[model samples]
Target: MPFLKTAKLSAIAVAVVLSGCSFKEDRNDIVVPIIDAQPAQSSKLQFPQETQQKTKTVPTYSYTVRSGDTLGIIAQKYLGSSQRYTEILALNELKSSDAIYVGQKLQLPTKGLKQPDELQSSNSNKKSSDIEPNKTYPELNELVDSQQYNQAIQWILNQPELSNNVELQEQLVELALTQSKIYKRQQQVADAETLLSGLISEAPLTQNNQKALISELSTLKAEQELITAKRFADQSKFDESYDILLVAWQQVGQPLENNILFTTTRNKVSEHYHQKALRHYRSQELESALVYWKKILAVNPNDDLALVYQDRVKALQNKLENL
Candidate 1:
C-alpha cells in the first residue's frame, strides 16, 4: 500500500508539470508580434468626405484649369464621357459647369484611367530624361490632353536636343501660348507677359508662322492688360489703371481698336477719365479738368467728345488766367 501511494504521488507531480507546460504554451500562443502598420495608399489621397464602397477602388486625378477648358471637354478626356460633366460639377459644388475658372482645381473621376501617381509609376520603367524626343512625344501629348500645358512646356525646354527639333519647338510655342492664355485668364498678368515675351524673343520674328504667333501673343497680352486696367479704373485707382493702359495702348503689334475686349476696356477707361474731367470742371478746377481731358486724348486721339472737352477746358483755363 505504501509503494502504491508513492507511485500515485509521482504521477500527480508529472501531471502537474504537464499541465503547467500546457498553460505556458497556451500563453505563448496568445501573444502576437507587433508589426509597424503601413497606411493604405487611398487614405493618403482621400478627402474627408470621400468614402470607399465595396466595389473596386476608383482612382481620382486632380487637374488645374487652363484657358478654354470646359467641363464637357475635361470630363470627356478624363472620364470618357462629356455627359459626366455633371459629376464634376456635383463633386466641386459648382452651381454650373460653366462656373469653373482658369487655375481652379478640379477633382476628376478617372473612370478607366489610372491616377497621376500610378501613371508616373508605370512610366518610371523608363527614365524620361534618357528617352528620345520621338519617344517622349506621347508623354508630352498626354500632358496637353490633361491640360497640363505648363508641365509640357517645361519638359520640352528641359531637353537640350529638342531645341533644334522644329516639330517640338512648334509644339513648345503652342503650349507656351496656351499657358500664357491661362495665366491671363487667371489675371496673372506678370506671368502671362513674361512667358509670352520669352517665347516671342526666342522665335525668329521674321518667320511668317512664328511672327503670326508672336503677334497673337502680343495682342492677347494687350487685351489682358486692358481688362486689368479697366478693373483698376472701376475701383477709382486711375493712376494705376492708366499706367497699365499706356503699356497696352503702345504694344505696337496689332491694332486693338477692332477687338471687342480691347474696345470695351478702352471705352470704360475713357469714360472714367471723362467723368473725372467733368468732376473737376464742376468744382471750377479748370486746370485739373484740362489735365484729365488731355489724358483721355492721349489714349484716343480721334475722340470727338474728348477733343471738344479739351477745347472747352483750355478755353476756361485761359479765361480764368486772364481774370
Candidate 2:
C-alpha cells in the first residue's frame, strides 16, 4: 500500500513538470502519426503554399475567388478589360465549363493591359485639353485609360489624327517589344515546373521524404492540368474553349498590333484554331466552326484554310436562311 501511494505521488509530480514544458514538446509532437487514425495532410497543405509563393515572382495579383466570379468580371475589375480573361484562365488553370465553385482562386497579371495606376493616369492625360483622338503621345501612359489601355497605344498608329506622329508611333513599338520579353519570362517558370515533374518519380518511397515529394508533385499536377486545358478548344468536352480562343485572337488580331513576341508565333495559335474549327464543322457545328475560322482570318486576312472555311460558312448561312 505504501509503494502504491508513493507511485501515484511520483506520477503526479511528473505530470506537473511536463505541463510546464508542453509548449516546447509540441514543436516536435506528432509529426504525421504513423497510426492510421489521421491521414497525413501536411503535404496537401504545403503544396498550395509553395505554388503561391512561386507565382509571386511574376508581376501578378492574387485574387481569392468569390461566389459568382467569372474570369471576365475579374479581368474587368482588376485589369480594366474583360477581353483579357484568357490571362486569368492561363494563370489559374480554370477549365472552359468547369463552373468554378465558391472558394476557387485566381491570379491577375499585366497581360494585355497596363498597370492600374498607369491606366488611371492615362485618362488624366487625355482630358478635354486634347482635341484629337490621334494626338501624339510622348509616353506610353498618354491617352490610355483602363478600358482602352490594351488598345490605346496601338490606336495612335491607325487613327487619322496621329498620321504624322511618327516619333510617338516608333516609341510605342519599342515598348510593345518589351512587353513581349516579359511574356517570355513568365513562360520560363511554367516550363521549369514542367521539367521538374518529369524528373520526380511517383513510386512509393520511404516516409522520411515522401511528404516533401508529394508537395512538389501536387503543384506539378496542377500545372499539367492547366497546360492540357490550353491545348484544346473543347477541353473536357465543353463548348467554351472556342469562344475563349476567339477572344484571344481579337486581342492581337491585326498585323499592326503584332510585335516581336506576338508576331513570331502569331500564326501558331491561329493555325491551331483553324484545324479545331474544321473538326467542329465536320461534326455539323457550323456556327461554332465559322466563329473560329473568322478569328484566324482576323490575324491573317489571306489565310487559305480560313478562306475555304469562310466560303463554307456563307453557304451554310444561306441554306439555313432559305429553310
**lDDT of every model, 2 decimals:** 0.58, 0.45
**Against the true structure, what is every candidate's RMSD?**
33.6, 28.3
Per residue, candidate 1 scores C-alpha lDDT tens digits across 108-206 of 776664344325555458532332234557888777777777788778777776645777776677677667657867988788777777766764333
Alpha-carbon TM-score of each model against the true structure: 0.36, 0.25
lDDT of 1: 0.58
* TM-score of model 1 vs. true structure: 0.36
Off by over 4 Å in 2: 1-260
Candidate 1 RMSD computed on C-alpha atoms after optimal superposition onto the true structure: 33.6
Inter-residue clash pairs, candidate 1: none
lDDT by residue (261-322, candidate 2, tens digit) is: 33324345665675677676545566788888777655544343455446546655564444
